[model samples]
Structures are given as structure tokens and as C-alpha cells.
Target chain A: MHTATHSGALMAETTSTKDAEFGAWMTARQPALLRTAYLLTGDHHSAEDLVQTTLAKVYLSWDKVQKREVIDGYARRVLVNENNSVWRRAWKRRELVSDQLPERTGRHDSYDEGGSADLWAHVATLPRKQRAVIVLRYYEELSEAETAEVLGISVGTVKSQASRALATLRATAHDRLGLGEEER
Target chain B: MNHDHDDLAAQLGRQMRHEVEGLDRAPLSLADVKGRATRIRRRRAALTGAGTAAVLAIVVPMAMLAGQFTNAGDDVGPATDPPSVSPGPTEPPDQGPVVGVGESLDTADLPIGDVPAVTWLENGSVLHTADGENIRLEGTYEDVVRYDDGWLGIGGGLAVLLDADGAETGESWVTARNLATGQGGDVVLFVADGELRLHDNVDGETTVLRDGMPDTAEMIGVDDEDTAAYNLVGPQGEPFAALNRDGEETIPDPGTDAYVLNDVTEAGWVSAITQLMDDGTCSRTVAPNGDVAGETCELMFDRFSPDQRHVIAGPAYADGYGAGQLAVLPVDFTDGDDPVLELLQSGARDATLMSWGWEDDDHILVVTATPVDGSTDMTWQLVRIGLDGTVENAATPVRGDEFAFPFALTS
Candidate 1:
């Protein structure tokens, strides 16, 4: 009975330590996660919701994730999957409308000054999967293999999707600017 | 990787970083995440238990059947293999009603006229209809400016003039920036090394419009009266100015707030967003004489209609990551009158407004993702929305994971 009580106390202490570690990690990484989520969803409210859900999933799998160096990757995978699922679920349920308007944040310094706005606009027009690849590979600076793993696709697919996405962006840019044929 | 590809990748990274820079972290707490985690754990546990029970029930029956089959197999004519049947192709699931405002009609129901348009970037090629022929423009260009006699193809920091047949005319400008057509495309205006110059196609001469201009100055458009409008970005803010034939500057009073120029009309009217506060932003148009032509709150004017009678706008400071509501407001409006003439709500959730352009003086063509009633795949449809609240599908839907419609026109 004494050994059982001691074991119980030790287990509780270990759980508490795990919780503390996860809380610290969440606080430290929340901003970066939110930025990626915003890029994926394009709305502040939706991005916040996505990040919250992603962190919760991470917490539930903390035991497995804490032992690996791919915690960020795991969280990112959850984020991408959650975003895809949210859109699909919205379509299935036909409840896409949100009652509250998305909250507006302050304009970042040098916004749209460097012609990045046009590029970003074109990025928004990309398909969801292709867009995800671009976000992971370009915005997050993930390698092709890493992007493939995060998206659960083969590396060859990652390469093709990234290529197609870039091509589309170039073509769209020309079209937007009323430019003709791409220089060979 | 190619140089252009590398440049694009770098630009994309910079742009994405710029988008989220200075954005405040969301107010989420570890406690909130933990609470949600507990619920998720409980639900998953319940599901696991039920799944285990279901597996056991199936496994017990299968085990008994296997034992009986093993005992009787030798006498059962080698247990004649059950007729193997391959599963047929699974049909796409139904997605439900098409989401949009008002009645939805097929593209055939609309009135037909000559829809002379161009669709570009199909496998690195551009196709346009000219004189009833589908002409493909040769070579890839960074920017193209259409003129009455020829096209100006800008790439690799050089602006090469191309004839109507997409052939180079040997007229080119080096290091050109912000090239735009003025005086009904009879001339092209551009800034080169802080000098605003005009190239007259009729005279085959290049003349300097104004010197000592800021490098950030970009020619927006030119009015019929030989007036050119341009905007400059400085530390203070972005302020738009107009220059007439006599080289006089008409700098509009942008009030005391920073403003971003959206579009400038051929009539020298400027539409811009100002007062970008935390609450919201405001959009207004300034006339050539520094008068406030029209103004609207909580919305940013995207572009002027082809006739310049109305402006299509969306929510100000909107991330525009998804489909949202769009509104059309008359360019000429009183202070107290309602600015919105019509509001087009994106009816379905997850439907994104991909590309939009003025179809004609009375209609606007918007390409949006339409959910397939039962499948995960979405179809792109060209929607024609009229000023009088009429919406119709202007083209047959094409199934794809990406937006496939390529005939997006500049508004």
C-alpha cells in the first residue's frame, strides 16, 4: 500500500512536469505558429482558431512528440491537416458563413511597398494543396523532403506542385500586368 | 534552379514575412489549449473503446468460420474460391446546394455578344482573340502594355516594343519602371532613374514629362486632357499627384493620415484608402482639382468599373485569403447617401473569389470555386454579376483542384 501511494505521487509529479514543459513551449512558439496559420487561412480569426486547435492536438500527443526533434514538423502537419479538414467540413455542412467579422490588425510596416502584395495576391489564388506546398517550402523554408513529409506526399509530388505553383504565379503576374509571352 | 526561380522564391519569402510582420500574437493561453486537449483525449478514448469492441465482434465470428472451413476444406472440392469481384469506381459524394446570392442560371441563359478576351499562362503560353483569330503571343514577358499599334513587352529590365503580330519593333527602353499607357494608348508613360518620360508612338519620339521625380513614383493613368496621375511613397505616406501638359503638379490633400492608392482613373480621379486605424479603414476618391469626389467607410475600393461610373470594393484591410462579400458603389455620391448600390455575398463557405474583371459596362465576371455537390473536388465557374443584382454562370464548370479559368481581365 505504501509503495502504491508513493508511485501515485511520483506519477502525478511527472504529469505536472510534462504540463509545465508543454506550456512553456506553447508560449514560446505561439507567434510563429500563428503567422503560419494566417498564411494558410488568410483570416485572423480563422488563423487563431487553427493555431489553437493545432496546439491542442500537439498537447494530446505530447508524450510521443516530446521525445522527437520534429515537434515543429508535427505541429505544422497538424496545422495543415486541420486547415484542410476545416474547409472540407465547411463544404459538407454548408455553414461557411461567420457571424462576426474578422478582426483587423495593424498594417505591417512597408506593406505592399516592395511589390510583394501582387505576388501574395497570386499566391492566394493557388489551389489549397499547392498553396500549402508553397507556404511550407517558401514561407517556412522547409526542404522538399520535409514539405513532402509534412503534407504526407512523395517528394516528387512536392517538386511538381512547387514547380506548378511557381509557374502559375509567373503567368498570373504577367496576365495581371497585361504582359505577353513568357521569355523562353 | 534557374535565376528567375530563385528570385521568385526569395521574393515569396520576403512577401510572406512582410505580411505577418508586426502582427500581434493572438491572445491564446496554455490553459485554453490544455482544456481543449482534455476533451479531445476523452473523445478519442471513447472512440478507441468502441472501435475495439467492434473489432472483437467481427474477429470472433471470422475465427469460428475459419476453423470450420479448415476442418471441411479437403472434402469441400478445395473450397471453390468465392467468385472474386472487384469493387467498382466510387462515385463522388454530393456536396449540396451551390452557394451564391440570388438565382443561379447556366451560362447559356445569358445574352451573347462578342466577348473578345484573352486567357494567358496555359503551360507558359498566352492566347488572345484578335479579329476572330486565336493568336498566341510568343516568348514570356514580365509585363505587357497594349497600345493601338503594338504591345510593349517588359522583361529583364528592358521594355521591347512588339508589333500587333507579337514581333519586336526594335524600339526598347532600358531600366523602365512603372510603365503605363496614356492619352488612349497613343503614348506610354514611364519613370526611369527619377525622370518621368513619355514615348509618342505617332511621332516615334521620347519626351521627358517631368524630371526630379522620386524613384518611387509610378504612373497610374493618364486622363483624356493630357493629364497624368502618379503616386509616390515616402516616409510620411503615399500621396498621389497629377501632372498636366504644362508640367504643373496637382498634389491632392490626403488629410493627415497615411493612405495607400488603389486605382486612378483616366479622368485623373484617384481612389485610395486612408485612416487605417485599428477599428477600420476608409476609402475615398479624389478629383483632379484636389476635391474629395466620393468616400466610403469600412471598405476599400478595388477598381473602377469599365465605364468609371462605379467601383467594386471589398472589406478594408481584409486578408482576402478566402471569398468574402463584395460591394459596388457609384463613383458619384453625396455625403449622406448610401454609397453601396449592391452587395454580393459569397454564398457558400470555402468558396474563394479567385479572379474578377469587368465583363462589360453592365456586367462583371467573377471566377469562383464551386463545391461539387458530393465530391471533395471543386469546379471553377465564371459568374457574371450584373449591376441590377443578376447573377449567372457565364461558363461551363471545369473540375480541378486549382482555379482553371485563365481569362481574368484587369478591372
Candidate 2:
């Protein structure tokens, strides 16, 4: 208990030293940030990448964060940028592999025990933007504006992405997933 | 009654979250990354060891050459004369005072919106959505960008950027009642349309940023005196390609353009631009390296999700959250297996979707057609996809007429 208390102080000291505002900025925001990143990337690794990148970026701007408000907005923006860069590389790699000879499906998740195996199976099925939007808006409970901040977009854009994402999830829930029968 | 749909959705969220992996830094310390960053110190470290020596050898000549050119590349500070690329249309100097000169307003009764309509006005001026009757904000708003609230009692974790008279700031509208009580310190108003919009926060009155940038009002992060803003691209209404302050239609340089901004993580402002282009269906054109879509690579995704998942859509990362979901889709095994988003929820459907309608909160109106036999078109037969993460072949697909679209609900 003493160690916990001390480490809590240490953690605060470290983050505060890194960016005095960061301790105040993301006091209890790690878990939530992780969740938001997870939803956006659909992969835990990618989500963590986003969160860490955000933290690092926040560290650099510790002063502005404390002097001005909206430190959270700044951090969220960094996370969104990191996530986008990831898929940009992915899309680029996909382009390079577009010409590769087709290989038979050998690693389908139907047999994988990893819960994420199935979760990602569904997430991958979503368009990248909607998936990111969904995680920020619904899971993290950020409003359209906040989501936009993390993602660096307009409120209108948030509404549009959410609408599109909702529709797709709804449809997939109904037909492919047969969600209606379960609710009965 | 099976509550499997809710169970599955919740489970998926939980499991997927639990399964996430963090960035493997291996053996680096937080101190290490910091040390590395400190070593680089931006432009100072940009000059490489070899490049530094090479420049040293030619430093005398380069300095003389630099004198000829207006320090195009100065001591890593803002250059006096940046290399000009394609020039854009130039407008006359902004013809207005940068700040309000003792202008006053009695915001106590500024016709602000009441509860659940127009949100309270920030700085005791302007009406927010809390009181707006059907999204009413009078005349031309030069620009707008949204911000995520770190739970600061702003608008649902985010604040809408304010652009009027050429000034830029971010604050959410409050209800009439909340405005009276005050949100925080001096309302810490920012610049709007070249005017000062102040706010009161825990701290006393603070003038955030002044005369920030012209025609380039955006969500700017300030460091010391260096502040970079992500320019809002693709002006709405008229489609005249905006020129930067220099009146250059094309981007000043590759980095300034707002295309594929989401793709560049180093630049912190990409998320803001991402949302601007992410206006539901507004498409953005930018390269992965965060270059202008026009020059580097013209790749863009929907500003919003395109009612279906099959089409190659990028993550709406640079924008906000609250949109996107999981759906059970019939595995498409065709020539170009683009999985069409079937109806599971009305919210997810694009306004243009015909085969989908809403059934309830979690489910939507679905139209299935005999599993789309070879060469057959997807017809209107509504079905349900559950959230249980279970898939069972439909016994019989339903008809489209049994559905209802709120008419107001369109992609």
C-alpha cells in the first residue's frame, strides 16, 4: 500500500515533469485512451501505438498544455494522426501486394482461440474511418466535437461518419450476423 | 427473448479491448525517447553530421549566397521568403481591424437559445446548439473545426471551432441557464473573424492567441511563439480553390496542404483537417506522407463511412469518434468481393441505401435476396443480424415494404 501510494506519486511526478499539464491532462485518461485507440485501430497493438504516440507528443508540449486549455484536444489529435499514418502505410503495402499471386486461406480465425481474432474479424470488416470514429464516439463516449478533435475533423464530418458507420453496423448486425434472432 | 445482440456487441467491445496489445518499446525508457527528442531539437539536428561538415566547408560561400536570397533557409527560423511554387489568386490585404476596439454587447439577453435548443453562448456571445431551433446559426461562418473535450464541461468532450469575421477559437454553446452560472475562468475567448472572443477559465483573463494567421484560422497548438495551424481545406459553398495568405492557389509547400493529413502523425494538426474533409460524405484527397493530395499522391477516403464496408474505405481517424459499428455481413465470394453493408441499424445506413431500414435500436431494416446467386442482383428482403457474434443462415429473407425510413434519415 505504501509502495502503491509512493509509485502513484512517482507516476504523477514523472508525467508532470514530462509535461506538468500531462498529469493534469490525462490524470485517469490512459484506460479510456486505450479503449479509444483500440476501437480506432481494431488491433490492440495499433491502439497502444496510438496512445503512446499521443503521450509522447503531449510530453513535448507540456507548457502550452498547462498555459492554455484543451490539452486533451491536443493529445487526441495526435492519436488520430498516428492511427491514420498506420493505415496509410497499410494501404501502401496493400498496393504493393496487390499483384502477389492469390494464396488460399490457411489462417482463418474460425479456429483461433484469441477473442480478438473474432473481434478483429468483425472490425476489419468495417471501413477504417468509421471504425476509428465508432471507437472515439461511442466507446470512449466522446461527443462529435471531441471525437473530431482526437481525429481532427469537423463536427459535420463526425455526424456523417457516425451515420455511415451506424448504418453499416446495423445492416451487418441484421443479415450477416443475424442479430435479430438473438434479441428475441 | 434472447438479449444476444446486446451481449455480442458488448462482448465484442470488451474482448477486442482486452485483446489489444501495447506498443512494444522493448528496452527503451521514457527518458530515452525524451533524450532522443532533445538530441534532435528540431532544425538544429536536421543538419546531419556529414551535412553539417559539408555545410561548414561551404558555410562562407553559402552565407554569401544566402545574402542574395532573402534567407530562404534562415537559421532554422521562419524564412523571410519561402521558395515560391505555383502561385494562387491573391486577395487584397484583410480590410478590417484585427481586434474589437472596446466593442460591447449586453449578452445577458442576446436572444440566446433556451435549453435543448441553442446551447449557451461562449464569451456570453453566440448561440450554441443547445438552444438552436433546428441548427440555426445566422449568416456566413467563415470556418469551423471541432475539438475533443478532455471532459472540461465543454460540448460532450469536444468544442466546435468558431470562425466569424475571420477570427478562430474553440468553445461549445451552453444552454441559457448554464451561461448565467459561468463555466470556468475568464471564458478564455480566442480570436473570431479577426475579433477577440474571450472566455473565463479557472485562471484569470487570458488572451489565447492574437493576429494568429490570416485566411488560416485553425485549431492551433502553440509552443513558445511557434504555433502551427492545420488549414481548413476545400471551402464549402463556392468551390474556388483558396490561396494561402500569399494568394497562392496551390499549397505553399507540400506540408501545408490538408490532404491525407490523417496519414502524417508527426504533424499534430492533421486530426482537425481530417474532420473538416470528413464531413460525412465529403471526400479528402491527400497522400499517405501527409502531402497535398494534388501533388504527392491523390488518395482519399469518405469524410464519413460509406454505408457499406466492402468498398475500400480508410479509417476516419483524423476526425472525431462516435460513428462506425460491427455488423454481420454475408461473406462476399465474388470476383471483386466488396462486402456491401447490409442493414443492421438505421444509423449505419447511408441515406442512399434502398435495401436497408431500421427495425429497432440495435437492429435495422435489412433486404436480403436469396444469397445473391451468381449473376443475381441484391434485392429488397429485410433480415436481422444479431449482436451475439453468431451466424445462422436466414430461413427466409423478408420483403422491403415491411420497413420504414424516418424520411429525415438519409445517408
Candidate 3:
């Protein structure tokens, strides 16, 4: 009976330590991690899914990850890769979304709410790379090099992507920008 | 009037901040965290189980014999199969790495308008699967964008992309075959072997961002696409002049009088070029970094007139807060060329400006968010300002939890 009791205590101790470690990682990365998830899903619903999955995955390896300072980077990479994987096999379970703009970018343009949605909608039409670039760049405020490191690519690619992304955004923006137009 | 555009941009910036401020923060959930770990473990067990492996051995041969993993049931990822490094069959050497090419995920069949199927080569080079079922775009680049032009840009027109086998890839607002797509969607840039290439996505072509190499690789700028106007801040603010397509680099000429300083924040520098037509001298106020342990105050300015007489200095703050600086500066400048420098607005803590719009060069329509004490509630208030320094506050019907940060302003 005493042995069983002692063993039970050991188990509880292990659980607590694991819990503590998980909490530490969570505290450090919760803000940045959630942001990545939101950018990936483009909506809060799926972003929640992505972040949750990442946390859960990281939690399982709490003890192992606690030994490293790169836990935050590991968690973020996991979140992004997982989100991309979901879309990779999305062919089978693809849901058709409207060509209309994503109405839920949090706020609308009353002067041209109609145009804001259209811009985002066109943004939605962009390739994953383009979408990811805009989100990481504007929303998260990461640098081209940092973003490249996160996304894992060359800096040249970042430039090319920006050019294309801006061109696309410029097309939608021309009507709304109300400025001296420049010829392409 | 250059102020007209600045006013318009300021309004858009305010709105974007508001949208960001409106995002709902998810409540913390440790139980949820515990649950995820449990799920991943169980899946790993299932994948390694005797029954699963035995079935896989037989299924592989059968599928190959039958022409493919033809069944849609394969959609369920092997319980243990997530987060695995999926380097595609043909991966480009890391020498000229593709920007943001991390773990390979399943490709999507997005409608790439005019292009054929777009397949990210196992290599860094992207494969264009044209209508003829051809996979090309290989051997076309080496050290992609080596010291020259390695990245490709497809401007505003629709670009159709296909995979190696004619699968529809997603379209691009623009594609930075390498650079711009990373952190700053507004600027595609790369810094390798001491060379820095910053390109703007103003159109399909990639233009040099700021010339010169930054001490660090942090790019701080956002795609305010509407203006073909976005702001960028580089690490250490080592000023590099603009790069023209003629392959010329504008060396950073800190004219003792006019120079760029990026020491305010590690996020790089903030350069707002308000009006191109302004004969006015523009200015930026930067508070020295590391000097403020808590919150030392500073200001930023955008000069648009001459003689330091007409500059748009700010009530802006340079602190790290959820909403961009509250003490946003109102434009106050002179009409001279004698290196204009003036104090604008002091940074405020409790103030939140959601969006700002301009009725004219003089008037500003500011959208602001004010947090209520003890109420856990935030309010969005609209205020207007004039060149004559007249201020008016108005309430709008625009209020909700969905409003996001960096709410954009419109003219």
C-alpha cells in the first residue's frame, strides 16, 4: 500500500512539472503564436484551431522543449506547418467560399466599406505565398529577412512576392485611393 | 496639395489600427492545452499499431496496382504524421533559398487566372505546369537573384498558375519569386552576403527598396496597398539611398543636415513621405532608444511646406502599445528649407485613435478608441481637425468586437 501511494505521488509530481513547463512556453509564445494562426486561417475560427493544435502539440513535448530557448520558434513553425498541411489535403474537403471580400477583417470602411471588402476579397484570391506575405508583413510587422526565415525562403523571393502583391492591391486600391493615378 | 494625400493616409492608418484593436482575445485555456497533447499521443499510437502497419503494407501495393491512393479516405492524415519535414521530391538548394519555403504542405488548387498549374518544385524553383501538361521554369535561375535579378514579378494583371500536372494554384496579388512575400508584403527584400535588395510591389515590377545593407535583417513596413504607398523601417536605420532599375545603388549620403535614424525601435524605422508635390521640407522626430525605461516621450513629423513653416509633426508616441501611438501628431509645418525641426505632440497612454480621414489638407477625421475605467468597455469616437487647428468630436455607429488593429483611414 505504501509503495502504491509513493508511486502515485511520483506521478503527480511529474504531471505538475510538465504542467509548469507547458505554462512557461505558453506565456512566452501565446501572443505571437495566436497572431500566426489568425493570419493562416484568415478568420478567427480556424486560427483558433491552428493555435490550439500548436499548443497541444507543444504541450506534449513540454519537458523536452523546456531545455531549449528556441521553444517559441519551434511552436510557431509547428503552427504554420500544421495549418499549411490542413490546406494541402484540402482538396478532398475543400469548401467553396464566395469570391466576395472577407467581410470580417474586424472593421469596415463606411466611406468605402464596399471597396475594403473587395480589396480583401481580391487579397483572398492571392496564392498562399502572397496571402502569407501580406499577413506577416503588414499585420505582424516582421522584416523581409525575418519573414523569409520564418517562411523559409530567399530574400529575392520576398522582393518578387512584394511586387506582385502590391500590384494586385494597387489594382483594387486605384478606385478607392482617390489620388493622381500612375500609369503601369 | 501634398497634405491632401497625407491626410488621406493618416485616416486609413487610424482605421486599420481600430480594426486591430477590435480583435477578440481568446480566454486562456490550460485544459485545452492538456487535451491536445493527449490527442497527438493517441494518434501516434494508432499509426504504429500492429493492425495499422500491417494494413499499410498491403494497401501500398494495392494502391499502386490500382493506379493511385485513389480513395478519398486517405485524407485523414496518419495520426502521427503532422509536423514532419516534407521537403518536396525536388528541393532547390538552400544556396539561393526560396523565401519562406519551410515545411512542404499539400498544394491548393486556387484559380491562378492566366497561368497554368503552379507547383513549388521540390527544389526552390517553382514549376509552372502550363496547359500542355508541361512542367517548366527549371534551370532558369541560379543563386536565384544572385547579385542581380533573381526574383520575378507579375504585376496587377491576373496570373494563372498550375502545378506539374495541371492543378490550379492560387493567384498572387503579386509573387516575389523570392523576396517581398515574407514579413513586409509591401516590400520584398533580401539581405545576403552583405547586400540588401528591397523591392516594392507598387506594380508587377520589383523596385529597389532602400539601398545599402542594414546591420540586421529586420524589415519594418506594412503594405498600405491602397496608396501604392506603404512605409518601411530597416534595422539600425543605416540610411541607403533608393535603388533604380538601372541596377544603380543610391549610397546612403547622410547630408549632415538630413539623415535617417532607426534607433527609436528595433522594429526598424518609420518613414512617412506625405506628398510628392510638396515644395515643403519633411521631417521625422525620433526619441533616442534605451533612454526610456518606462516611457520617455518623443515626436515624429512629416514636412510638406517650406521654411520649416509647414510640417506635419505629431502628437505621436514611439512606445510599444497595442494600438499605434495615441498622441498622433497633427500636421504643423513652415514654408522654409532651413532644415525644419519642431516639437509636435507628446505621447499619451490612455488615448486610442481608430482611424483618421481628411476632408481637406487642413481637416483630419480621426477615429479613436477610448477605454472606460472599471467598465472593461472600449468606445470608438470620431474626431475632426482643421489646418486652422479646429477640433471636433463626433460619434459614429461603427462599434463592435470585430474591429481589428491598425484600422485603415480613407479620404
lDDT of each: 0.57, 0.33, 0.37
Question: Model 3 over residues B1-411: C-alpha lDDT tens digits?
Answer: 134333333433343344455355654588887786786675455433422342233222222211111122333222212222222224433332121211111112111122212112212133322122333433222112111222332212212233333233452232221222322233444443334444454443544433444332332222222111122223322222232223443322223222222111112122331111101112232211111011111333422211111223332222111223222232221122221222122333243543333333333444454444443344444444333333344323233321222122211
**Candidate 1 residue lDDT tens string, B272-310:** 654343223456754433445465554566567655666
Candidate 3 residue lDDT tens string, A1-184: 9999999999999999778867876866676676667655666667777788888887876667645777776776567656644432111111111111222211112236555544555555565555666666655656778766666544545555554555545444665554235533
Give every candidate's TM-score on chain A: 0.77, 0.62, 0.67
DockQ for all models, in order? 0.20, 0.05, 0.09
| lDDT tens digits by residue: candidate 1, A1-184 | 9999999999999889888988888888889999999898887887888898899999888887645577877899989877755443212111111111122222111123345677797787665677888899999999999988887655655776777777677666665744334443
lDDT of 2 by residue, B1-411 (tens): 124333443555555555544522333235544553464344233332222332233223322221222223334232112222211113322432111111211111112111221122221123343223232233222122222211122221122343332123444432110111111111322333343233333443434333432332222122111222222323321111111211122232333222222211111111112211211111222221222121101112321111211112322221222112222221111112222232221222211122222222222322232212232122232233222211221223222221121111111
Candidate 1 TM-score to native: 0.49
Interface RMSD of each: 13.0, 14.3, 18.7
What is the Å distance of residue B44 in model 3 from its true position? 2.5
In candidate 1 chain B, where is summed lDDT lowest over 10 consecutive residues?
Answer: B78-87
| Best-performing candidate as measured by DockQ | 1
Best by TM-score: 1
